[model samples]
Target: MDRPHWSVPLALVWVSSFFLHFAWEMWQVVFYEGMATASHAAAIWICTKATFGDANIALAAYLAAALSVCSIDWVRTPTGTPLFFYLAAGLLITVLFEYLATEVLGRWEYNEQMPTLPLLGTGLLPLAQWIVVPLVSLYATRLMYFGFLPMREYAANKPA
Candidate 1:
C-alpha cells in the first residue's frame, strides 16, 4: 500500500520541532555567554521564562511548527505559485485560524490565563504567527507535499 500514508509522518515532524525547540533553549541557558549572570536562581528564572508560559520560547516553537505544517499551499489552478509565498499564505491562514479558534473557545478580555488576549506575542510570542509560521512551513510543506515539491526523475515508481 501507499506507504501507509496517513498524517503520521507530518505530525511527528511537528512534534519533533517542539522538543527541538526545548532542547535548544536548554542549551542556550547552559552555554550562552552572559546568561543568568546574577545567580543560579536567576539562571533558572531565565530558562523558565524562555521555556514556558505565553511567550515561552519552547511552546512558541511548537505553535510555529503546527501552523507551518497546516498552512502549506496546494495551488488548484494552473498558474504556478511560488513555494515561499504559498508557505507564507499557509502560515498566515494557520495564525488567523488559531486566533479565531482561541477567541471562540473563550473571549480574551475575560481570560485570566491569557491576560493580554488582544495583543498576541506581547504576551504571546510570534509578532505575527502570520509570517513566522509560514516561513518555517515552506520547508515542511515542501518536504511533505508532493504538489509543491519537485519530483526527482531518478526516484522511480514504488514497488508493487
Candidate 2:
C-alpha cells in the first residue's frame, strides 16, 4: 500500500486529540477548583486552550513514535515499540507538566473530588487522559487512514 502523506496522520491526530481532550476536560472540570462555577464562555475558552495543548502533546508523541520506528507511517500499522513510545512519551509529559503546573507554578489545583497518585500527587484523571486519548486517537487515525470510515462520495459524474 502507498504511504499516506505526513500531513494526513498529523491532521488526524490533531482532530482526534482535540475533540477527545475537549470532552474529557469538560467532564472533568468539576474536579478542579473554581471550574464548575466559571462562566460558560470562560469554561469553553479554558477547555479550548487546554485541548490545543493536548493536541500538541499528541503530535509530539506521534512524532516520537514515528522516530522510534523511523517512519511517519507507523500510525498506519502501529505495533509494540512504536505504540510503547507513543504512550510512554504522552504519560511522561503529562506527569511532569501536571506536577509543575499544580505544584511548582500553582497554575491550578484539584478539588476534593479529584483523586491523585500516591507519591507525585498527580491527578488520576490527567494520567488516564494521556493514556486513553492517545490510544483512541491512534485507533481513530488507523480507521480513517484505512478508509474504514468512508467519506461522502463527491464525484461529479454520479447521480446529481
Best by TM-score: 2
**Whole-model lDDT per candidate:** 0.39, 0.88
For candidate 2, write residues 30-97 as lDDT tens digits: 99999999999998998899898899999999999999999887876667899999999999999999
- Model 1 C-alpha lDDT per residue in residues 36-136, reported as the tens digit of each score: 35487776665555333322332233334444445322311112234344444444544554466445543222123322336542223333433444344
Cα-based RMSD of the predictions, in order?
10.8, 6.9
Off by over 4 Å in 1: 1-3, 23-125, 128-130, 141-160
Clash pairs detected, candidate 1: 71-90, 121-124, 121-125
In candidate 2, which residue ranges exceed 4 Å CA deviation? Answer: 149-160
Question: Candidate 1: lDDT of 92?
Answer: 53
